[model samples]
Target: MTEVFENSASFASDLDSKDELQSFRREFSIPQKNGKSVLYFTGNSLGLQPVRARKLVEEELAKWAQYGVDGHFEGGRPWFTYHEHAKKGLSVLVGARESEVVAMNNLTSNLHLMMVSFFRPTKSRFKIIMEAGAFPSDQYAVESQLKFHGLDPEQALIEISPREGEFTLRNKDILQVIEEHGNETALVLMSGIQYYTGQKFNIKAITEMAHQKGAVAGFDLAHAIGNIKMNLHDDQVDFAVWCSYKYLNSGPGGVSGVFVHERHGDNPGLPRFAGWWGHDQDSRFLMQKGFKPMPGADGWQLSNVNILGTAAHLAALNIVLDAGWQKLLDKSRNLTAYLQYLLADLGKTFNDFKVITPEKPDERGCQLSLFFYRNGREVFDFLTENGVVADWREHPLNETSERAGVIRIAPVPLYNTYQDVFQFSRLLKLALEKEHERITE
Candidate 1:
């Protein structure tokens, strides 16, 4: 039975009072204005910093000062093996074996690195398949990879798009496209959760489809990593990459990671752009002439670990772990659903309001992409000014129309509260009415 929702502050506060994970909010440093914390909902973009990030970063700095270059081997947490520290944390998040994941370059760079090893195109099978509107960085990476192989992107790339009148792709359509182009497809790359629409693709289904077609399957899990749980290992994902800045609360442009299936990760002969750091650890410092790759995802490391960046990442990862993965998952589903219910109730009064993100919890993560037919930007700005932290994106209806815009709101479970969604509902109602009056006047 569905519980009745009351659009009241008391109702929301009561939910918070019953929340077992409410104490986790203190782990993050929430952004504030005029001495009050803003109602943060953009964790899908840049998450709030973990409170321990500063201290962890300072500790690394102290190690550097006290040990100088010796810090690489002399510190409490040796810089030479710093990236190793995050592997276990990342493994649990992505549902991969510890040996299959490693903290490394930023999101895009990791994509390029993964592609170098996974995207081997043949004359007969040279095509790449991906979601139509993947984040721009992934687009550029695919385009350049195709160009490098002397293949025209237009001819070698297949982008799965939404149906004529839809904002999200159907799983059936995605499978059909993969099947149609299976014979010629070299690889399938898609985001685990689409950034713009907040639709969580069925990674296991997509991976199985791609493999059945004999194509390497990979994913960019930037939005899905911390917002949703997935088993990359059991899903048989060939390779994947993600950034820690979003949902993971790892700070802006935080360190990224890659997941290489154990089947592929154990193969030292697999072609990859090698760096000294990726060489066998025991002999890495011996200045080996030949490349001897480390087993698993560590073989893909391009350079020595960034101790400072990994410090922040590990600090954030610890918080997520301490919060308990299943507990956070449960809270995310509940929080996003509560907000969804309230938004739906509030939207009943505004004919122009529409939600483009999928309504099913199983089809989406924690985000809701809201569309406004008119004064979208004005209302977005109004909400921003009134302490609602959300994201804005232009989704024009036509070339001549500016009225169609969207606000991407992500109520991250780690620190966001039921009270945050309650307050947002109230603010949105006012913004809609105020904008309507302003337009009429």
Candidate 2:
């Protein structure tokens, strides 16, 4: 049997004292409340900025100032190949070859671009399959893509949802849907980690199932890239896209990344929206009419690199790389496990408190979604007012049901500590107690 953890501040302090990555906490500038750093637990929404990000961005700004238009080739890092500096680091994060990855446009934009090449619809196989409650942007992108092909989204979009009264989708159910719609499904685009429920999907299995069904498989790793371990190439996923602003520690609206399996990278006949930057480096400046795309994922680029955004991403990737991916993932698993344990302890005191996120560590990353039976908004307000920085989502599982509100706490391994998790648990307990008293009064 496993040992039970005590719900005590001293126990949390003990855990912190033994943590190897505790020093990483000082590397970020934590938000302050009442002269103290707030208990920030929303890294899943927007990661805390790395202290080195400003220095990296300022370096690019200095290059632009010193070299003017010549910064393209003259600067130390050089604007011409700035995105390359981030490729190696991002490749390790997404588990792909450097040639297969490129830091480029934002997440939704990259998704659209990938869809241009991958979402080939025909009368026989013209449907797109996706998770029912995907982020709004993904939903909109798929709908628009269908319409662009002169297909009605209502007829061509297939959504696989959780069974009634369930908060998360079962893997078997998802696979069964793919089997049922195999013939008509043109694409299978789903999140590696479902953002709202903090559920991590089996990417390799899903990709295999999609392939078996004669459907192209891709993923939106907006919540998965930095939060979990992925092997996109080994998984045989056709393409994947992710944003850097969340767990990646890049600034808000930072440049995103894409992965095109090597199999698809060299196909000259693949359809894509082309631009000058994606032209062969040797012949790019020749100003030739016919487009010759560079090999690999870079061939999909629509414009020159976003220098400032790339700089910020480079800095953040450096931090992650320095810490080591395996080490970070190990810490992330433990940190989230500790948070879940504490939340369960709190649930013992508050009958209304429920954890909707999966109980198994392998099924989740660093986030836990807490569902309150009542006073959900009021409790969220209390946590905010008390200096606990978390996120709340009003997710309506179905049209006929009331909104299912949840408070999401992500104990990011890069900065958050065991003590932070303990503090959040304490605050949450107090908030629930207060809510209970107010109701009884």
Q: What is the lDDT of candidate 2?
A: 0.90
My TM-score estimates for the predictions, one after another, are: 0.98, 0.98
lDDT of 2 by residue, 165-268 (tens): 78899999999999999899999999999998999998999999999999999999999989999999899999999999999999899999999999999896
Clashing residue pair totals per candidate (backbone < 3 A): 0, 0
For candidate 2, what's the RMSD? 1.4
Local error of candidate 2 at residue 34 (angstroms): 1.0
**Stretches > 4 Å off in candidate 1:** 1-3, 396-398
Residue 90 miss distance in model 1 (angstroms): 0.3
Worst 10 residues of 2 by lDDT: 395-404
In order, the Cα lDDT scores of the candidates are 0.91, 0.90
The prediction achieving the highest lDDT against the true structure is: 1
